[model samples]
Target: MKVTKEEVAYIAKLSNLMLTPEQAEKQAEEFSNILNHFDTINQENLTGIEMYSFEDEPLRLRKDEAIPFKNSDELYANTKSMQETAIKIPKVVE
Candidate 1:
C-alpha cells in the first residue's frame, strides 16, 4: 500500500492539523513506509505454528455497573456554553 500527499492532507484536515506542503510530503512518505512494514509482516508464513491456550473453561468477568459522577456542576463550571447537558465548542468539521 502507498500513501499519497492528498490523502495526508485529507487526514490532516480531519484532525484539525495545519501541515505545509513539505510536511505533508514527509508525512505521506512516512505513512507509506509504516504501511509497507505492516505489509512485510503480513507476508510471513505461520503454517506449522501451534495454538496455545491457558484454560478451556469459560472465562469469568465482573458485572458491568453504571456509576454516576459526584460533582457534575463543578465539572461543567469552566465551560462557556452548555446546551442542557453537553458543553458547546467551536465546530471543527465541515
Candidate 2:
C-alpha cells in the first residue's frame, strides 16, 4: 500500500492538479498511510455488532398545538408599508 512518487504524479495528472516535487512526495506518503489504515480496518472482525439507525433512546418530540397570539393588524399598524395580510417591500426588478 505504499504510494510512489511516480504514482502520485500520475494521479495528480489524472486529476488535473499541478503539484511541486516536494508536495507530490508528501501527498504520496499521506495517501499511502491512508490506504494502509483502510487495509488494517478491513481486516477486523465484527461478527455480532448491531447496526445503529439512531441513538439508543427514542427522541422526545413536542406536541403540535396552536397557540393564540395578538392580531397582525395591530402589529403592523405602525409600519410604513403593508399589503393585504403581509409586509410590502419595493420591487427590485424592472
Report the lDDT tens digits of candidate 1 across residue range 1-94.
7999999999999999999999999999999999988898677897887777657877788879888989999888888999989878889898
Worst 10 residues of 1 by lDDT: 49-58
lDDT (Cα, 0-100) at 48 in candidate 1: 86
lDDT of each: 0.91, 0.87
Give a tens-digit lDDT track for model 2, residues 1-94.
9999889999999999888999999999999999988898778898888878568688889989987666967877898888786778888789
What are the candidates' C-alpha RMSDs? 4.8, 11.4
Question: What is the Cα-based lDDT of residue 30 in candidate 2?
Answer: 98
The segments of candidate 2 whose C-alpha lies over 4 angstroms from its true place after superposition are 44-94
Cα lDDT of candidate 2 equals: 0.87
